[model samples]
Target: MKIIIISYQKILFQGNIISIIAPGYCGYFQILKNHAPLISILKNGFLKLELESEKKKIKIKGGFLQVKKNMVIIIL
Candidate 1:
C-alpha cells in the first residue's frame, strides 16, 4: 500500500509499506497491506513504517489518519 505522511511544515514521507504502527487516540494500532478502510484520531507517539526496502519511524505530536482505496494518508 501507499503511505503518505504530511504536516503543516512539509511532506514527511511517501512510500510503499508492508505495515504501519500508528499511535491512535485509544492506543497504538497496526495497519497492514490490503487492510480495510479506516479513519482514526491520533495521539502523540511514533509512527512506524515497515517497507520492503527499509523500516522507518517518526515521532509526531498528533494527527488524523485515513485509510481508503489502498492508500493511507496521515495529516499532522
Candidate 2:
C-alpha cells in the first residue's frame, strides 16, 4: 500500500509500505494490505512503517489519517 505523511512545511514520507502502525486517538492500530477503509484521529506519538526488508518510525505531534483503496495519507 502507498503511504504519505505531510506536515505544514514539508512532506515527511511518501512511499509504498507493507504495513503501518499508528497512534490513534483511542490507541494504536495497524493497517495492512487490502484493509478496510478508515479515517481516524491520531495522538502525539510514533508512527511505524514496515517496508519490504526494513522498518521505520516517525514521530508525529498529532494529525489525522485517512485510509482508502490501499492508500494511507496522514496530515499533521
Please give each candidate's TM-score. 0.95, 0.97
Which ten contiguous residues of candidate 1 have the minimum total lDDT? 48-57
RMSD of each: 0.8, 0.5
Task: Please give the CA lDDT of all the candidate structures.
Answer: 0.93, 0.96
Candidate 1 stretches greater than 4 Å from native: none
Compared with the true structure, the alpha-carbon lDDT of candidate 2 equals: 0.96
- Model 1 earns a TM-score of 0.95
Clash pairs for candidate 2: none
Each candidate: how many clashes?
0, 0
Candidate 2 residue lDDT tens string, 1-76? 9999999999999999999999999999999999999999999999999999899999988899999999999999
| Model 1, span 1-76: residue lDDT tens | 9999999989999878999999999899999878898999999999999999888989999989999988999999
